[model samples]
Target: MKKALAVAVAVALTATACGSEEKDDAPQFAERGTFTYAIPADPGELDPANAVLGATNTVLAFAYDTLVHSDADGKIVSGLAEKWQAQADKVTFTLRKGVTCADKSPVTPQTVADSMNYLSDPKNKATLLGVLIPAGMSATADEAAGTVTLATKDPNPFLLESMTAVYVVCGEGLKDRSVLKTKTSGSGPYPLFESVANDHYVFKAREDYAWGADGAKYEPSMPAVVDLKVVKDESTAANMITTGGLNGAQFTGADRKRVEAVPGIRKGSAPDGIGEFFFHQGEGRAAADPAVRKALVQSLDLNELRTIASGGNGEAATHLTSLAPDPCRGDSVTGNLPQSDPAAAATALDGAGWQAGTDGARAKDGKPLKLRIAYQTSAGPGVQAGMEYVAQKWKALGVETELVGSADAKYSDSLFKNGDWDMAWVPLGLSLPTQLVGYLSGPGPDAQGSNFAHIANTTYDDLAAAAAKQVGAAGCGQWTNAEAALVKNVDVVPVVRPTQLVASKGAMVEVIGGVVRPTSIRMLKN
Candidate 1:
């Protein structure tokens, strides 16, 4: 699905904050003002069902509501549904009374059920299918009882947690999906007021809105209007935050120090996966060969690679998925990944029939071993430098490397559509292991599956299948072992864990699921 295809800015700041006292002195709140923040790129689509960009999710939070919500710590909280219970195969949610859609229509159980059912059907072709919500899942609502129950074809351990990503569309938007491309119809904290394609989007807060993560209610401290500005450059965004041109923005580049030096600015940091490599194991790709994959990994010092990728502000990654509210906290990558040994790498490449020619380039059967390293252009200079270092290492092994850079929005096209990349540095920022099943082990891109890497590790598939059957943490062991299978076999490489930092000025907010929570945004005094 789109979740795994795209790399979201996985920045989680606080679990549950509402302009409370962060210091001994409680900060003053403005009567009512506009809150402006910068998104790394333009949120391409407004429809939550088909889009998975962190920028879109940030904007969607102001207009859409999920069945349930989770705190930064992954604790389940009340959202549209006041109370709910979840089993391995089924989850039932009781709708909160007096909730209304943006159109002023009462939100009924049938509406919620319809939204869930629409997202779960594979025929609908919603990108969230099989990733956020399981495929073939069905939802039924009892109008009289004010309850909606969801049942999946197969048992999903994190079904309840997964619902947090299922943004419920109103009946009108579901009927005519075209209008949703540019408008908002769901019941959230704010509705779309205006949008300018690549510039900014404006939203006005709903005065009557009361439902939020962790039972948060709208207050005067909350912004009357929200502005999401598209600022691609991290240095410009940092400067904006320092000069009070913006309320908040996340930075992963060298410019973060500039913002941190400014006084009275609020900041939050959390781990986000970086420098991860996805080797495209397609038919003719150089990395398709296990020997080549092992040799390539063995040729580099991953610890140094991590430092290069994160600007010396990261640690060796211990797991594949690093998004906050992570359910499974296990070390699947410590001893599983290939060790750094240049001699071993040379031997493996030589044994694979890749011989060095006069030009120091390896050729086998008259075809040279070439690698195309694809990375996001907006991932900062650190990622670019790290990828160049990788290119150099592979070049030392007599393999030709080409650095292919793509924008954040078009990176997926380069990986899936162009099908030209040998390896990519996109990190899958998923909170749960079940959410990674579609991307890591399943039908490949040709069959419309999210496994763009074309990984076919039977051990991973079998272990993942077992993990999917267990309830919640009961199957965490299987999930951990499954992730190890991917690393041990060199299907994917988890390189580094970088701390994602977000700076704020004139406002205080919490970032959940990689975007600022609209309700948690509190306008501060001058």
Candidate 2:
């Protein structure tokens, strides 16, 4: 299936490209060249085990190859494995032959199985764990049979779908894992060439690289050497595209004119991605108060948040899994989640015994109603302004807000380290809400994975578990209801699913699933 898809893409691109035009004027097929793009933030962890940031994904995704690959729409297809069959408590896969790791190591059936087992082991403490693979699942290899069997403890409805996230690295890289932090060592399309710390990372295409998924390749002026430069500022990134010094950038929120102002620059966007707040509802916290959570939800305007967050290019988010190839396939969000009304919010707070003072600050028993809001460190000026706008609106409703930021904060530190924060602007995008099991349940703030909200509701937990038992489209309704359950408890404030917009040189590039995948990009005219 993957090869067929690749063939189709190659055919389409081949048919459209001009063969008669001058070689210099047409797309220059360089034997070896470089492609440069600006990265908004530094990927804190390059290794798959500890990587959590989207910034990291952009880099690591190209540097490593997963066992199973998903399409632009999130449909799972074969990568290193050619085929598979599911059994009662395990799934067996036929490994693809001649696959080689970036280190020039052979990727045998046992090698592939061992890599999966490496991540699955409880002792390894891989952060991805159940989020990427089934909880307590292990893979065993049979070399003679040329197959690997993934055995799970119990039924995993989204197991196959979630396996799409697993990126397999070779045994050599796995032994000395510390070196992987600074370099790339996997069977990925682009291998790591050079690293300039937080400034830039340069990658080179392999001469023997023929394992591209679905006919994906960086041929025809795609540039042999790829330079990923770190440019934190969106406005600055836009200028780089215009000047043609930088090839393109992954930018968010209102920078179309700045980019299109340059000739031959093209822009593409995907409206399916989501970015919303996960309010910390720990005990004694003001957000813990159901009334306070409701008021907080009601006071802030979703539409306004959308406008400011995406510079009017985004729409208000409804469900947790808003992205395509999403496990839960419906707009489960309701209109009653929270409507921004200062009057209503004020009334709700006042009735809950918090009275507005002459200074327009709410206080109860000499305790002022203060809320501290935290935003992502990588957020641009517009997003920061949007957060400030929301803060101002909350302040007008007699609530005082304190804004703070952590430098590329980790998932655990953002929740556990800073226990004082009431509401955080932590936006998590998941292809499956089931990917949130550990986040919503489990032990401590650190143990609960990305459950930054610190919610421990038995009702929501049970509902999610029950929904996880159902498979495929049959489970969509249950999953939708499970999301509704979270909304009902006000565990999270679901906001707009912002459209992820990227601007690039119209030298013929395509943006799939809101990303400029290194392999999928090709050139029309240089």
Candidate 3:
């Protein structure tokens, strides 16, 4: 869902890299315990239909249940729906029997249909429009058969896989969506017990919970209560995890080293999140010029930038989708990006009629080459330093640079609504290539699409359209070509895939796209 940050709109996806291994001397599981964790920021919207940030998804995961479940390796398995069949244009999900909502109401086939229909409707304007469920998709229920069939107007090869992210709201929540802001309704292992904005959220496991990934049932070893506290500072979170104040927390910067030093603390790593760049190619923007965009990318030492941005915890990215279990797995970004050569960048800028003055300032037709760059401050100091480094390199190139750093809310507004930026550090964390289409091609903010960059790469668009029609891994070649087209055209730049690190003190944490999966949590007894 870059409902993962400009999720390349606001979400950033990350997958766990460790903690799935079993050892001969594995720790014993506790009968019951409180599994508390940290979220970097507050998840503003609790409604599953409107969740835009990864933190929101993290919080909602406890209360909501998707139609399908993704296993440790991201394989689609049974969730709320037991058995499912997918097609290019449609998917049928057979609901598991004896499932119930938070209010103890039976989860009928219509319950699932209504949730899907709500997202499909244009009037509802759900955030996951085409990301989770395809656009123009409709749902029909066969109550007698205990199945819900979703038919899409456009062909969607990853329909079943995408449904893993679609959080189905219970009938009561749908009837009065406001209730969702403070409570839970869907059937999950845990139900929302309490919620305090910018503070903490608590969930208690359901005693009779039976349905989970692959028919998993609630056990005595699982946490009785899950407490999610919002800790904005990474250092503080690291400290909390080490001292047993928090059972789990993700560390992305200097604090990561602090937590890893604690010998007994469990950790999971993933090359899921990326520190990518998006240029505003809209009319009148300097980045709209392909030469300028290329020059900007070429001016900086991306390898050094990656090291700085990730606090020396990441490697060079080779594709757009940084999240794990990527359906289209391949290297599409390796040779596509412009190599770092400041001199070549200057030459390219000069060739584009941008002349350098006596003070080394570049201008064209008396208009100085000024560019405004913005990034989400929530990404931490490392990211800010990386953005500042970009400004420094551009300054050497005689370009006037303005850096604006804001939190998620303001940054999201600037990207999708105000459009008051030239270049942005917006990483759309997507596991599937089809998810990138809405952000990189098609209509933009004005048309209610996620193309905040206003990119119009026809080559990429054509390739992506063809790729979307192909079913699953068979379209990897086409998808790779489509992504290559975007990079070659300078519409977007893949910087580095940062390693996402989560440290747990007493609970075994499994992260999916940077958030701890509620079902994968188990209290450990040492």
Candidate 4:
């Protein structure tokens, strides 16, 4: 099926660019060549600690080098640190010598220490940092010995994996945290040379970068230059690929067909992690009813929704940890999750005393079954399609769904934080299980403190806290239990898992290895 699709696309492209043979054979790499890419939206922030989305993290992953990094396979690998040792609750890292930032400041143990402290500090905790580090963890640096010690309140099995996000920014980079909101300054292989929000961004390769992984095969003869141009419309991006103007860009199902039709353009999809809508369980209306929440989950038509939302490109998700590797062996909950059944949904609604009215809308007593769902307009094409599909499904279940779309990006804060919306389509990304602690724990955003979901569960909190302390198999089991609890409780519904589509001009772009990291894009020559 995949091969046939590929062939059909090639045939379509042959007709679109009939006289573009010379451009198809153009040299992919030149001494000072620049490759232009089109991003879907303008990155909200450049600070590694602040970035939450994959696109923003892609830029930060190149601009900043973390203490530890994940390889192509998402395995933990040393980045700025050559080696490290863990003793009980303390992990000591041996900093690599002779490393310097883009500003030419030497990277020392003090720099590592300062950066770690800043990230782990409660005052400076951003969404990324909060997801990376455990609660009550601190770091101490020894410049003379070239080592930085991390002290944890409890044993953390996934500490190294967590460090994959602990980007080591220099002291100069820390002069003003807000400045990093728009600008980037780091010691990674790439440096941000120019940035015109939602228009174009340029990244220049670092000539002095010598601290890459031991066996990593990244050697750019030409000073690698990455030019990212924001193209909101996927059709325009696909058009650029055929015109030989863009090296690579993301595409939708419609754009994918158009691009594949172009003779020399290649179409590919990488696992984009999971994408789902989370209900603010602590907010008004639905906050007081668990049966309604369960009914909502049961009412979803997974198969139909996945088809429409993915445009035949994605799969239905069963758990919060979708597409991620199973951390625990011999665990029954690994792939065991409830499927959608309308009969079950009706039963759940009946149990909650919400009977269908003459208008086909469910109601309890005198109140109608109405819900307001808020979604960000800039989340991407797939999300928009997914939201529409979900809203339609909910309507079929005799529920009134008020669909609200926003572009100012303040919808998430206003809806989730202020409890202004009953449900929202929010995509939360985390590489490891430990990274999900904040979102699952009670006292959520709706609560007084850090809870974003506004739903509280003492049982779920206890299981998550205990699981976080365990390492390896034991830890995985506990985490799995916590995940099961969340699913069974219907704290949040798991919808469709999305795959990222990177459309590029095949003649001018050759993505070295099929290494798809959610946080970075390292392209190579043909």
What value does the lDDT take at residue 185 in candidate 3?
Answer: 82
- Steric collisions counted per model: 0, 4, 20, 6
Per-residue alpha-carbon lDDT of candidate 1 for residues 321-391, written as tens digits (9 for 90 to 100): 65545677789999988899998998999999999999989999999998889987767788899999999
Which structure among the candidates has the greatest TM-score? 3
TM-score of each: 0.90, 0.84, 0.92, 0.81
Candidate 1 lDDT trough over 10 residues, lowest sum: 12-21
Q: Which residue pairs of candidate 1 clash? A: none
Candidate 3 residue-wise lDDT, 222-321, digit = tens? 8999999999888889888888899988777788887888967876776646668888888777788999999989999889998888888888888887
Model 2 weakest 10-residue run by lDDT = 13-22
Between candidates 1 and 4, name the one with more favorable lDDT: 1
What is the lDDT for 368 in model 2? Answer: 91
lDDT of 2 by residue, 1-526 (tens): 1111112111111010001111224454444556777776677668777554456766776788766666655666777777877554577788778778887788887777777878878787776665666658888899999898888898777666656566777856767778778877788878888888789988888766666665354454566777888887778888878877787775564575667567766556555356567677776677777888888778877777877876666676777764334656666667547677878988999988889999889998898988888765555555587789888988889888888755443422545555657776655556667666665665544453445567777777777777766665557777777777777767777776665545567344444332346665555446
lDDT score of residue 34 within candidate 1: 97
User: What's the true lDDT of residue 238 in model 2?
Assistant: 84
Question: How far in Å is the alpha carbon of 487 misplaced in model 4?
Answer: 1.1
Q: State model 3's lDDT.
A: 0.81
Tens-digit lDDT track of model 4 for 1-526: 1111122111110011001112334345434456677766566678776654445655665677777655444445677888888654777899888888888888888887777778777787555444556667788988888999888887777776667656778746766677687777787777788898878878887756777554232355434677777777778887887888887765544777777677756555554445566667763576457778777867876667666666676666644542222234223233434468888888788788888988888888888888888766655566677788778878988888888877534664554346677777665433456656555664654344445666566766788788766664457767767777776666766555565566655323322112222123333355
* Candidate 1, number of clashes: 0
Stretches > 4 Å off in candidate 3: 1-24, 446-449
